[model samples]
Target: MLHLQVFTFNPFSENTYLIYNDNQECWIVDPGMINEQECQELFSFIESHQLQPQAIINTHAHIDHILGVDVVAQRYNIPFYLHELEMPVLNNAANTARMFGFEYAGVQTKPGFLSEQHLLRLGNDPVTVLLVPGHSPGSIAFYYEKGDWVISGDALFAGSIGRTDLLLGDHPTLIHSIKTQLLPLPAQTAVHSGHGPSTTIGQELNSNPFLN
Candidate 1:
């Protein structure tokens, strides 16, 4: 089994996931930590556990979700990974934050893109990349087949779904992503979301007001 740690960070309360394997090597998923304490906690955890961070993976490039991209990228000398389409969104994080009347620094648009051909594996687990657009043009989800788990970014949520009013978001596409990318997973598979508590694929299929 993979070792997982979650940190709810930033004013947006984005759930950043740290995934590591038995070798003590790991990857950062959508690290949006805003405050010093959050960053310190994350770094402290890595130092204490002796984890070598290999990569920075972004589910999408929303302003709230990519806040810590610079911190980790600069500190670890690792590249940030996102879909090609999210480059513009990431580049405009400052504007997004400004529009919301918030002051956020380190809004950069320089990160690598991840395609279906690219794969991220830790230990024996291989994370299959699924380009799940709709919540955002380049939103993607990572599925660990053997582990029976899916890390759903902002595409799907508990009792709800990601808002489509934002940039490049379409309600129809979001619905399609849910029906196709997420619903096909095994019913018992655990769904780890970008925010809120974790839920099962079966539970969301049956109970999520948006999905139903």
Candidate 2:
């Protein structure tokens, strides 16, 4: 079975995830560690668990979600992946950081692109890439069928949804994306969001104010 671990990091309290399998191989999702101390926290966990990080997979390229991408990717010598449409957002990271009063050296590594056409795999297990969009132009979610869960960037939340006032955000599109792409999942499927606590698809469907 695939195992999941979460770390709440940075001033945004973003949730960074480590998805690993029995083989000790893992994919680091949304590495948000912003400083030396935070970086060490992530490294220490990986070291303690002896996890072999294969790649850094992102749900989106918001500044807070990607602050540690460069550090973790370089340290592990692994490739980073994001949807092709988030390129502009990724490219604007430096400016976004500056606006948010955060120090950023900029992301030096290029990223591999993800799409609905492909599946991301760890060992023999496969993860379906769902193009959910709206929170950002290229927002996506990682659905692990075997694990019965999805890492939903900022698209959907427990009782609310992602704000559409940010760059490239559109409220109508976000609602449509959630209804068409995410809400159809099994009710019991767990939703691991980019921020705050985790919730289930059913919980959100029944109580999420935005959805209603």
Candidate 3:
């Protein structure tokens, strides 16, 4: 079984996930640790558990979601992964933060593109990539087939959906992606969002105002 550890960090309260299997190999998804303390906390856990990082991934490249990508990637010497389309979003993170009067150190590690052809695996587990863009041009979800859960980043929320007011966001496209790509999953499948508590596909399908 894969174990998922969540860390809420930075002003955005973004949820950073560390997923690992029994073999002690793990993948870091969206490291949001902002300061050295936060970064150390993450590293300490990995060291304490003797977890070997396999790769670093992002569901999207929003500033809040990638604050620590640079630090983590460099520290672990791991490859970073994100959808090719999100490069624009990632590239714009620094400017976006400045506009919001926030500081961003930016990601220095070279990132590999995530596509269906490029499989993401941890030990014996296979993680499927779902192209559920709309929150951002290249937003994606990591679906763990064994757990029947998806790490949905700012895409579908508990009682609401992602806001489309930001740059490159489109309401119609967001809705369509949720309906066609996410809602079709098993009702029992858990939805582990980027900013809030977890919910199930059935819960969102039945109650999410945007989807219903």
lDDT, candidate 1, equals 0.86
lDDT of 2 at 126: 90
Alpha-carbon lDDT, every model: 0.86, 0.92, 0.89
User: lDDT per residue, candidate 2, 50-102, as tens digits?
Assistant: 99999999999998899999999899999999999999889988888889886
Q: Comparing 1 and 3 by lDDT, which wins?
A: 3
Candidate 1: Cα lDDT at 131: 84
Against the true structure, whose lDDT is highest? 2
TM-score of each: 0.95, 0.98, 0.97
Ranking by TM-score: 2, 3, 1
Per-residue C-alpha lDDT of model 3 across residues 114-203, encoded as one tens digit per residue: 974355778878888999889999999998878999999999888888878777988999999999889999999999999989999999
- Candidate 3: Cα lDDT at 99: 80
Those runs of model 2 whose alpha carbons end farther than 4 Å from true positions after fitting are: none
Task: Give the C-alpha miss distance for residue 56 in model 1, angstroms.
Answer: 0.3
Better-scoring candidate (lDDT), 1 or 2? 2
